[model samples]
Target chain A: MEKEERKKKVKEEAKEKEGRLTGPRVIGRRDVLKGFATVPFLGAFAGAWARKRHIERELKNNLLEVVHLTAEPADIVPVAINSKPLRLGIIGFGLRGRHLLRATGHAEPQWIDDAKASAASNRLDTSYEDFMNQEDLNVVINGVCDVFNIHAEEAVEAGANIFRQGKGGKMGTVPKRYRTYKELIASPEIDAVIIATPDHWHAPMAIEAARAGKHVYLEKPMTWNVPETYELVKAVKENNIIFQLGHQGRQTESYIKAKEAIQKNILGKITLVEVCTNRNDPNGAWVYPIHPKAGPDNIDWAQFLGQAPFHEFSLERFFRWRCWWDYSTGLNGDLLTHEYDSINQIMSIGIPDSVVASGGIYFFKDGRTVPDVQQVVMEFTKHDLTLLYSASLASDRQRGKVIMGHDAHMEISDRLVINADPQSTAYSEKIKQGVIDPVVPIYSFTPGKKGIDGVASATEQYFASRGLLYTYRKGRRVDTTYLHMREWIHCIRAHIQPSCNIDQGFEEAISAHMATIALREGRRVYWDREKEIII
Target chain B: MTKNHHLREYSTFQALMLVLLRVSIGWHFLYEGLVKVFNPDWSSFGYLMDSKGIFADVFKYMATHKDILQAVDLLNIWGLVLIGAGMILGLFTRLSVSCGILLLSLYYLSHPPLAGLQYIFPQEGSYLIVNKTLIEIIALCLLLAFPNSHIAGIDRFFQKKNK
Candidate 1:
């Protein structure tokens, strides 16, 4: 008891002496107090009245609107093309690339005794924690390629570990590093490729991969430009190979349950849907600090830029490509597409009839071309649905992805909630039978609920639930990337469409491009679905 | 299909605005809670000591009493977080808002608008019969009166599953 008190006193005193125990020493008492004083009740009376009027107007207007939507549970089966022991190669060994490697292994490394001394007495944010926790890869990671020397080395090491495990410690099975993606794609030894490169390289590499007859799992925002969208679509179709776009949210259990609820005609007729991107941290924004080691010497500046207009080498541009218009599709393609694809998966929304995007860089004065705050209204004219997306990099808010039907509204995040509409005629029988209350939430589904009981932080869990980190298979915690990758592998062998496939990828690319054009031009962009082009 | 798309858009915008308001308030609460949660040394001692409201002695007592003070601190930080997350996500919103009302009510009473209540601490902006806490309590009341979740957040998801 005395020891505990002493320890507690020391800790408290240390904290009092230094406002923050770690990170930076910028936060003092005055700063903390200032944080408390900063930005609340901004509208004062006008804001209150504005929201009141808005709610009043909304409730009255929303009553008359209803739409019934269906969620098609894609029965993705194998097409009987190939057998097991499917050969796979990976390109791009950055943050996401490393995460994908974790997916290939089964049992997590139970012990990392060698790195324990650096933990500094239960420090959670140890730099080596991620590097140490490696899973034994089951599949044969045959090849690796990266423009950067460090990335390439990491890939080789990670793949070698995986290979050693899969080959039963035969040793000397280091994956032969390729010079370029084209060389890797052409390699007959590799049957499939997971393209985790930047946005600009997605189409170029994918097009090459398709031509080389390698099944591709390209990342999201599948194309660099409008023309590349059609060209990549053509390549995949002509080659007749299984193509999976990396919108891993397709495998997310929360969204899948949301789909089930929607299929049950919960939200009567879906008229409105709102999705968000609220991440209020420095790392959350694309202002990734330039690694001290990343210079022109080790980095491939020309290859990184690819087909984009050339400029002098800047580490900021190379490291944080997502913040720039030259390489990235900006907020519309990078952020909005996630929300769009999720809703599209649930609602099976094709190309929207029209799109109106508006927002600006209200915060983060880091000279990012894309807006920090983004809002887009996508009108699905035929389905009588309007999809609204709101994103902010300045504030962290736990707003769920919402789809509203006249009868009910389906709120999908980590948990799915359906509240019966008081005026919902479709659900009148259930209400009358006391099966559901008109006001209270009718149904709830929390994916991986039991496993997430003692989570360290809400922020981490938020990312986890989105299938960016982890998920559950039969209540057992599993990396969602594994599931997504498994589906891609299964489809490659089974010869079927993976969750986010060619047509869907094309759709996303086209739609994202449309929104991008609208936002860029500051006008409403129309999609001529028949022509398969943005008008 | 016959409905005016513009009207629907306008109404949806207005409705989303309400959700944003709820989100803004939720962000404020959740942000503060999370900041304190991350900061192990954070305590409500200074705020309690500088209490300028009616219940300064009570607040001061709660701050000074080590055992009771720990509970108060835990409840205050976690309470703000829970209510904020609920309001933001529309998950357990009713309970969170109810808890928020209780929390804000305590805050209001601790620093009530009654006469002869003054302390060394400074107040942010001016408040008469209704200050920030009371105003928030009322705002929460308005939000509770008509939760726009069905129109915006997770409640919409739950609303459909029951049907």
Candidate 2:
């Protein structure tokens, strides 16, 4: 009886010890699950922190004008104009302004449907209504600033404030009214001026407008040279007038999103950026449509050559202004400034340290000053970044903006395409032989144990055909024209700088100007930011 | 071993044929396999089903699940390098050919029908699985028939050299 009792006691002790070690298999499964449950919580916390950091970085980098101007809602005062239904004055009644008016008027709402029709088009319509509802403007002046006179009737009909005069100043006077820029800038009735004039006239008109305390929307290539650029900035600051640079790309929602993605490190550390704008014909060289009747009768010749050496009022020079070095800064300031401004806003990289370029007028020898093919390399010191800009008037191969980073490459176009480098087969072979096959348990898994759920075995067969791991993140497409324009207008109302403000515009202009100088001088030109010149 | 008795010897003729066939098959495998092993830019997983339009969806999914593709790539490289070397040398002749056949068969099955049957030729009327897999399968058959050890091979050399 005692022996039986001892055997029972021994069996019971063993059972208790086993229970203590294994912790009741059924109950332990629950505890294991409980421990696993906290994993998601920790993951969520890390994800949120990462997201917060990205948001903070983006906000800091973005030159948000409204945020800088107003903190309290009550401090914001809506501008009141004399005209009913909110007047919009567009000073530069040129090609850009006409397109702007057409886009803002017809496509503003209808563009939404068109974007939805095409998968590649970005969804820019979501914020379009916000622009119309944001503020009540008194007038948007349509000024005569482009190479050709943009019909002011369109602005007038579109419910905008139009300030325009005939080609020969004050309705066909032999010389042209406003021959001296001071007369054009000092027009009292005009509430504001959009300085979309020639490169030389840009600074003088802008400075005068700022001096007159009138809001100004100055087109790109902010000034003719570095000294004038400084003077323009000083004048704007001193007068405390609402000044916005016409680097309209900053207003693009797609660009803004790309910038946000970069600041978020979605692309990791950006090392190289490539921007290419190419065309197959001479028209792409900015030799715009020349009217059959283009002459001194239709163009203000003196104003067109303002501040620059006076030349004969040739129709070819007036219409194809971009092809000449006398009026336009050729390929650099004419086209490159727009790209440079957009890129600076996107990558948040300041002025480049050095710039080198090589280009020649090889293709279009037809009365053009700029090269048919131009390639510029810019090196930035602040972030160890390199940017290359290639523009051609001959080739049609378009390799648009590309931002290469460690993780992925974010390419901007009508739609954004983020891609990873294709895996090397030789490297993969080595990994399979040297590392993965030996280490990964999943790789070597075999059909051994059967699950309790009564599922069939031979599970290893399923694991044999698996491929490598990679992730792709793509955003919804969105157009930027309306958004960029709206952002500019909003900045004006808030008394803050626009997205592509004067500083960004000047830097881009300098970079573009340097590229031209490099090509012209047959030597590399480095940007000296402190000195503000091409060295 | 007289000259007249040699005329009736089927074994000698068979061995001669086998030797010639095995050497030829081994050489082909070695040549193809070595090139893939040494070439740096070769990638297997990157373009499994890359195409325009809807085909992009297939490639995108394949791109995400790459481990298996990677393993297969490694296997192919080694199977060509080591097995091809072994077969060509006739050191582990039968074993090398078997592995080569196995790898070729797996690749054949991965993308069946192997593009088109039309390859480089004077348009000979062909009706067979004449892909890399088929070549390997034929090589394996030839290897099986070969008296690689007794015939001209390193297996015999090693045995003789050591002796």
Candidate 3:
């Protein structure tokens, strides 16, 4: 019995040793503690994140409260309901004319196929998608007119392409082609006319269209010369027709916001505004490619020289009309007018008191009379500001529009950025307290983002400046030209004036003429505000 | 104990250092993922568009496709979050390390530190093919080779149970 008890005790001791070596089958308190050892690190991370977010939120709210500006995009006006489908006519079926037609839901079959092929190869080219998604304005192209037979044929094909499809697709009824703008304007089926002709032809076509009781959408630099600027305005006003000049910058979202900022006095005591245009290419300098098929037989050379000085039937003069002063206002009307109109829309700085301009045909010496490089300075004594305009067709050095003030300066493109001045009377207190950093932007509005940022990164600023970021409204990219045309169509139906009305067109033309005279005459030109004349 | 024979035993200091490294990387990944999740406007579009080097076209192609970009963004965010949580808890740490390495490799390849290349998004510090992302990837590789998660992490329970 004693021996048996000893063996049993030894066996029990061995079992205990094995159990100690293997560890407990069930979890112990010590094991549980070891397993959760890193939980405290997660806790620390949560605490730190929450604290950082809180601090950032507080600072953002404080700065926003001081700035007192909402970063929301302007509300898009909804199309008027129960409006009838309006009839349309297009007069110059050139490059720009086709673009306008496409915006109104018609595109040539060749363009559609090209756009599709481009989109298929390069996914980043959203042009096809954007064009397909554009809202139809419910207007039929009933009449088409062009001096060149090829352009007229293309316009007819494009006008009939209501489906916006590739080649060999179903098409709508072909529009009737007219040999002259007068014939198209007088057509009973046409309710509105779009004038996209040469600068010299803009006023004549528009005036005739206005007198024919048809609404007009005239392309800009409203007139070729100073004399007809008055005549076009009088005809549109007296005829009581809805007129829209093609200053599409009037529909730019950033310009709308800029106007609001000015009204709210965001930039205190604005003193100077600067704008620029830089393009370095053959096409940009008006060395447009002449059609191989174009000649005296296909083009109506006599009708083309409507009010301009007579010129020989040369394809260069016919296709690249902007290079000559006989048919073009050169850089003043071709490019600077766009910059001037954008600034005018934002600041409402009417015709300046005096303008001095100078430049020469430094580049593209292709026997062109127009200057490829030009600079015009206009003094606005009433507003205590000077508007500086500069252009260079030989060098594409991007310089954004800037509006300077005592307290801040704003740089505007498709996005708007305002930086507080280092030495300022308005924001001096905030800058001293470190709440507002002069180096950083005091306010920045980027469309498609949730809210404004007090500080934007260099990448954001760069993209915004280059207009690569947002032409978006509520996450959808929209073409400003489409919007501009829509506005004109709506105004024709509503019997109202569009944004770029006759009055605004008058100011745009006179200002451009003043600059041209200053450049040509080699002296300062003054606007006689009392008599509405350039002296 | 027999199964652990194949695994090298680490000293207390060594184990602590490994755990610290794993947790800090996890913290970084988690924060980045969370920031993207919280900001609705956040997109990889700009970064991919600005991609340089040999794989630039591939990155740009990914950005241009809307559906692919959305899917990529979701996968990137959740991949980071899951990998981060796994690393911190010492669960599935090897898989996390491998995935983290893959992601870092893509980022590095997309924006290689080659001469004559400039990026719009400013970098905090200059680098010559050896940025912080590369260093972090090396650290993760170290963790993969000498893993201590089973010793001091939630992985211990599973490992212990398996034994």
Off by over 4 Å in 2: A1-91, A101-181, A422-479, A529-533, B1-163
List model 3 lDDT by residue over A55-165, tens digit each: 767767766765656534445566654577788999998888988998788999999999999989987677888899988788999999999999999999999999997
- Give the alpha carbon lDDT tens digit for every residue of B21-132 in model 3: 9999998998888876776666677777789999999998888777788887898888888888888888788889899999989889888888889987788899988999
lDDT of each: 0.70, 0.55, 0.86
Candidate 3 docking band: acceptable
Deviation from native of the Cα of residue B102 in model 1, angstroms: 30
In model 1, where do residues sit more than 4 Å from their true spots? A1-84, A106-138, A163-172, A428-435, A449-475, B1-163
Ranking by TM-score: 3, 1, 2
Q: What digit string (tens of lDDT, one per residue) describes model 1 on residues A1-535? A: 9999999999998776444323243444644432333123333423664675575445433332322223333564543434446667888877777667655542112112323445444332232344434333336677888888877876876666632232234334578898788788888889888888878888999999898889988878889799988899999999999999888888887787677667767677889998888899887888877778878988888888889889899888887888888888877777888888888888899889999998888897787787888888999999999988888998998577888889888788756656788788987876676555566555544554332211123343334344422221122344457668768877776688888988888778888888888888999999887786788
Error of model 1, residue A366, in angstroms:
1.6
- Two-way DockQ contest, 1 vs 3, winner: 3
The deviation in Å at residue A16 for candidate 1 is: 73
Local error of candidate 1 at residue A350 (angstroms): 0.7
Kindly give the stretch of ten consecutive residues in candidate 1 chain A with the minimal lDDT sum. Answer: A106-115
Using DockQ as the measure, which candidate wins?
Answer: 3
Q: Between the candidate structures 2 and 3, which one is better when assessed by DockQ?
A: 3
